[model samples]
Target chain A: MGRTLTEKVLGRKAGKDVRAGEVVSVSPDYVLSHDNSAAIIKEFRKLGVGRVRAPEKIVIVLDHIVPAADEKYAQNHKSIREFVAEQGIPNFFDINAGVCHQVLPEQGFALPGLVIVGSDSHTPSYGALGAFAAGIGRTETACVWATGEIWLRVPETMRIDLGGRFRAGVFAKDLSLKLIGDRGAEMANYKAVEFAGPAAGELDIGSRLTLANMSAEMGAKNGYFAPDEKAFEWLEGRARRPFAAVASDPDASYESVLACDLDTLEPQVACPHTVDNVKPVAAVAGKPVHQVLIGTCTNGRLEDLEAAARILRGRKVHPSVRVLVVPASWQVYREALASGALAALVEAGCVILNSGCGPCLGAHEGLLAAGEVCVSTSNRNFRGRMGHRDSEIYLVSPATAAATAATGKLTDPREFS
Target chain B: MSRGAVWKYGDDVNTDVIFPGRYTYQIMAPEEMARHALEDLDPAFAKGVKPGDVVVAGKNFGCGSSREQAAACLKAAGVQAVVAKSFARIYFRNAINLGLAVLQSEEAAGALDTGDAVDLDLARGEIRSAKGTFRFLPLPASVLGIIEAGGLIEYTKKRLEREQE
Candidate 1:
């Protein structure tokens, strides 16, 4: 029977021909755990799962409660650390290792034509590498721990094609914001979004990852770009096994189709309260900004840091505007620090934050005060999402955010350079 | 058991508010967390809610976050059914996984109001209120089976047990 990526991955994992809308037991090539719910070790203990069904499939990382803020957070990490030690899980990254999504593909745990599941929503970020990844609950994670398999319903595919070259200073972040604004967040719920056409092919793997990572913000099951030579180059040094190059057949049908020309695109921003409340940057130009953040698993890659560093290289952040920079992972951090990006940001008076979610989830640092305005490259601008319920968040590309940080007002990157 | 009392909510009542971001790190005491359900939107929600009530909301409900705490809070609050115009995919699965009953009805989301007494029939996908009877889009057999068996875990357990037999 013919199948889509979701069905193909699930079927191969299950050792059977999995069908859409049918429940089938399928093993996952990779399973991920984070500190937020590692406490489920107790639940696994009660479930009587003996030593995890497949230890090699387990990929655990310490992310959510990083650096162990307190005794409780410390215990959360301790629980997972003990479980990983006892079970002999093959892939375990401590807090220094970085956010699971960033480091997973970085170290080559995620590959094309595989199935991966994490205990966090952004697990879909791995879709950029052409894998099927989704977030599941703790009990489901426990079940996966018991049996490296899960049941899945193959989702219909949605095709979004872009064919033109982007305008100056327009980044993938702006393109994604344009998408979410045009279609609304739930437009592609429970569906796969495949990117194609000239513009997508021209984008580097890092930018593609930024686009795929935020698919969750729009409620997509996963977003994928077919495996390219660059992907092979990325895997050459890391992975041991052969990977299949997966893409839709030339004539593949889509449940829906959306097309945009990159040449006509503009730098966009998501207005306060909703990721979907999007508008072109020109509409909100000159708006006051209290803060600007240039990071998150979404845009915290080396390219993102380089973009911000380039804009802030010879300038200081406005005294009234606080700017925070967080690399997606420690690897990115060390690379930036070595390449002078970190020093440039520090010299510009930007707060260099740790490589965790921070401010993105409002759990750790960088919460906005009442009525304060922030321009960030992070996904999701939901109300009070960054901290104060009344505080407003503006979502922009990394370049725009850096430029805005230096100016203390919403400004486009093109205007400065 | 009779379908319990129904509580109503407006549309787009995202997963973040159902279970705030601050509490995701501590998910063991889901019931205690329920005390703050919708507290961001309605400060008195925890006090106003009673067991077996239903929550009805507008379109694109459960829009953000995949935290199971959202469903866990609804389950802890003893919410019997959630009828909305639509649900975000992960939240839908999480609610079903946690044994919380959720239904979809564009009309029900439009007509229902807070404090209105509602009786929901899971099998029929019908909502009966003093104002009138409203029909909902029927649940697929799979989702119906999940709800009947008390959620995904229980459903999976039942399947596993039956397969063994």
Candidate 2:
């Protein structure tokens, strides 16, 4: 009879008690779109609507392909600006901002007990703050922008309790890869995953964000971690409004319960062609790594960058390995620069990119040629994810990535220190 | 009811292959996207596609990333529907929102192979192929409503008119 966090939050938004498998309509707190806003705007125009129904509930971010890769991309950006100007929409973050998911929480658009939808899959990144967020298509986003309301069939809940403490060199990324590997990507399809237990609470907001961010790769509708004092501390003055904390009842409905023991887990990697194709770092050790990328929406936070910097400092990158570092947002980028993390990375022969989704999506920045192997901290390792189908990508933690760059092979980070 | 030849894909056929990340930078229209639909996975998909064709695949069709362009490209490639063992949550919703039909039927996915002829009765939630006839759960009424309205654009347009009224 108890309710899950997904049920509790969605029921409140729907103005009634809801259950799994029942379709309900509700107004979300905010809807987000990034560079894809250009595509969304085009679709909105096709609907023959003159203005956005609720501009305030919509936040637009221009991070992908910033500075416009070419005239086509530049034209897309131009139209987005025109749309924002005509609609007088606030909360429009230009190219200098960061990824949409990061910018939303950073600027206070993401708050506990709220429902947020975005045009990007990693929208669940906000769930670390106790908000219910998920990715929707551009057309669905257009609908949310038009009416501020969306419909959903409350997904079943998959409760994963991360218990025990993490050993040295083990991180949220390793745990995430472990979960995906163990459960497989589609095990939680059409389901919301709620993280609980001691280890989940002990994680910093950044690490929690990493877990929430990779929920997309696990095929989760969204990922939730109960908002406790740590989340409140992170949102101190940044939360848009005062929100009553919400949590699932102790006996809440769950499709299944999984206990992820961090004490026994080791550094993990998702090998070429599939995220769930996970392997322990030692299994793939000594494989040649031509490039090492240590930043992305999933792992481009201050903690991740700082970890990579600490490992790479006073050590030159392997001559054959190309290292690239990209901060998730302008704020993170500035903070990393101010704190000298960027300097350490640069001195170690890493190419520091602007605060944009660079090679993660394989949009020309840091692309891999045929037969090349890259050790990346980004989420996916699908074939052709980084460019040529023959090229390969190995997903790793930032520490392992930095260590790999230094040695030009899949080396564990703990060995370096 | 409709009949079409199927182009089969394996399990976990991700969005990256259906629409490569290399093209993410190019802001192209749906039709433009169709030109390269599944080019990375099949290489012959776009040029070989015909209107009313269907894509049959194993488990987890259209997994990875929230890009709606994957569904849009398939729709633009004249794919009438996609039948699979299962689907990633976002891809399933995106397909419905973009006016592309998708269904989950383990039997259909397991029996059908590339170039097989399929008789699909979408209204009745049945797929008849050379192997056999299999049934799938019909999409919920709400999703059917959006599909009948020709996707979210038209659905939202009607909603806007009612709001004004």
Candidate 3:
């Protein structure tokens, strides 16, 4: 019997053969935490561990509420700094680095064939690099820090084979929304999803990140793409250490297989209140939007900005709309600026915020008021996610967000194309 | 055995609604968080919930962000156990690590309604109510050990002490 990527990775780490549903304790290659490190520190202290078991394996990034949104957040950051210094942890990215998901990969910490766990649910984003990445609770993270190992249940694998090219203006975000819509939020619960097939090769690293990041929305433990030439090329200069990429055997068993054709896929939008509440761009067309945000761990890369800039170049944003562009990391920000994407967006009346998680998680920056509607490229349109409980958020692609910003309503990106 | 009144909810009751994201960065005690538990979903949940009350919900309960506050707030708000048809993966671990009981049984989730009285027997993996008796697979032994030890913190402490000895 052949082994799936997840079983292979976990089995290697465990120093023995493993299978789905078997719990094994193994030390992970990397463990990430963000602003939640403040809370995690408290839990760590309770373990009475004077020093972290493996400081090198820990990565901390402070970007959830950058520059300290208020006194409370400021104090949290202060404690985290003191903890980092006291513990002598070397891999700490201060406020300016950007979101943890993007920063981890950009800093060369995410590598293939490694088991990575983090405090944030989107830690699966690293799976785009062919790593076995999963999210765990803060207490579990603290325990890992204390013991240098954690238990994991090898998840059943779900194979999603993507074939055919996407239509113009329809990208990976659309495909992601479509998948989540067809399979409800709990469709992949306790499972690992592997993205494969012909069309998977066409997606760039940024698009792969979007798909892997949104895998959390479908209750997946992790999502991954096999490391191909593009992945190896992208990691050549960024990987901190040499890694042996892992892949599923040709005949590996899967809990289920879903085949998706991207040729006819249209722009998709996750309606307000639920990520699975999805509809085609045309279904919700003409709904007025108060704000249009294009950024987050899901879609805040340079390519995302360029896609938005393509639609908004030389065009003014609607008078009733406010467009905010947040690059995923400082590196992406510099690249986008050099590529003229930032210039085009700014010239079109879009506001370029610093490279941080601007308004994706609603910690600060661009909060919405009651009765307001926002069209955002970020994932999760849950009620009160970006501000007022009554405010609405429609999740769309960067191009769709830009198109909506131009018209101050829910508009399809294909219309502009 | 444990017993409580039921506070029922529908499918996909995400962590964002259990504890709003706006308070993610705010440093507050667990008790204070209990005040805002489910404020957006049901304003009465915080004020009316009594100690030992249980939360029953449809599929995909506690879905969304991996913020531990979602599980913390429910534990702080005096929820004895959560019975749902299913739970998001991360939240299930958080609940168990916090020493909160979580039982999965579609039969109980469908039969229980708001205000229904119920008894949970963790040892027998059964939920008894006026509707009837529903059986759920008990948590694995390793997981049940953590809950019995009053969460991961205490469990880790004991392990460290044993190692040092």
Mind giving the per-residue lDDT tens digits that candidate 1 earns over A191-235?
878877777878888888988888887788788887787777777
Chain B TM-score for all candidates, comma-separated: 0.89, 0.96, 0.97
| Residue A378, model 2: Cα distance from true site in angstroms | 0.6
Better of 2 and 3 by DockQ: 3
Candidate with top lDDT is 3
lDDT of 2 by residue, B1-165 (tens): 568889988899999999997886577777999997997799899999888889999888999888888998999999999999999888999999888999899989888888998888987789988788999978888888788988888888887888789
Model 2's alpha-carbon lDDT is 0.88
* Per-candidate clash tally: 10, 0, 0
TM-scores, all candidates, are 0.95, 0.98, 0.99
lDDT of 3 by residue, A59-119 (tens): 9999899978898999999999999999899999998888888998888888889999999
Query: Candidate 1: which stretches are off by over 4 Å?
Result: A1-3, A14-23, B1-8, B143-145, B155-165
lDDT, candidate 3, at A273: 91
At residue B1, candidate 1 shows an lDDT of: 31
Tens digits of per-residue lDDT for model 1, B136-158: 88866656776787665666556
